[model samples]
Target chain A: MYVTLKDGIHDPQGKAVKDALSVLGFNGVEQVRVGKYFELDIAETSLETAGPLVNGMCDQLLANTVIEKYRYELIEK
Target chain B: MYVTLKDGIHDPQGKAVKDALSVLGFNGVEQVRVGKYFELDIAETSLETAGPLVNGMCDQLLANTVIEKYRYELIEK
Candidate 1:
């Protein structure tokens, strides 16, 4: 799961990171926004079943849907 | 860029989030590892050119190469 701030939202942590990068002499980047990425080891085997289950997890627990949006990709392990 | 703890590295924040989820009654998940995701608006246009530049940012400032690993995708914005 990836949870990122919606566009137009201010990201103070991202700004701090960008400034720290500039201080470290990396000047090639801008408008850095930060978010959360989760690597989940779900008990389910099928993507068909896991999708909604994970969505429920995100909706109820993982993401704050008001200001943040989330996306997930399943990687077979 | 994404910054995640290497395998076998303990993630306290991830554990906390997972515990919070369990407390909120989502119990079908396990091994929930969390990481940092960055949406960077790089000044460069070409992926070929931006790849190395962003790699430099990760190496120098974004990721702690010792315990964390990073990967980035050049999204056209």
Candidate 2:
């Protein structure tokens, strides 16, 4: 799962990181947007059941949909 | 760039998310590891130059090599 702040939203954390990089002498950096990524180990389930399940999980738990958005990809293990 | 906690590292934040998921009835999750993803818009440059540059940025500022490691993919735009 990846949860990123909506476009046009201020990302102070990313700004801080970019600033730090500039201070470290990396001048080519034009912009930086930071987001959260998650690796989830889940029990085996059908894709049909897993899609809504994970969507619910993201909307209800992992991300704040009002200010951020999330997308997930599932791989069977 | 993707920055993830090294294996065996304790992640209380990920643990809290897992616990919350369990309490919210999404119990199929066995593990949750959280990480950071960075989308960087950098000046157009040759891949050879970009590779070492981004690696240096990650090592020096984006990730703490002691506990976190980072990998990045470059795309021309």
User: What DockQ does candidate 2 score?
Assistant: 0.89
Q: Note the DockQ of each predicted structure.
A: 0.83, 0.89
What is the per-residue lDDT of model 1 for residues A1-77, given as tens digits with 9 covering 90 to 100? Answer: 89999888889999998899888877777788999999888778888998888888889888889988999998776
DockQ of 1: 0.83
Q: Estimate TM-scores for all models.
A: 0.90, 0.95
- Residue pairs with colliding backbones in model 2 are none
> Candidate 2 on A1-77: residue-level lDDT in tens?
99999999999988988899899888888899999999888885787888898899999989999999888898886
- Structure candidate 1, residue pairs in collision: none
> Please, what are the lDDT tens digits per residue for candidate 1 over residues B1-77?
89999999999988988888788776766878999999888788788988888888888888899999998887887
Q: What is the C-alpha lDDT of each candidate?
A: 0.87, 0.90
lDDT of 1 at A4: 94
Residue runs of model 1 more than 4 Å from their true location after superposition: none
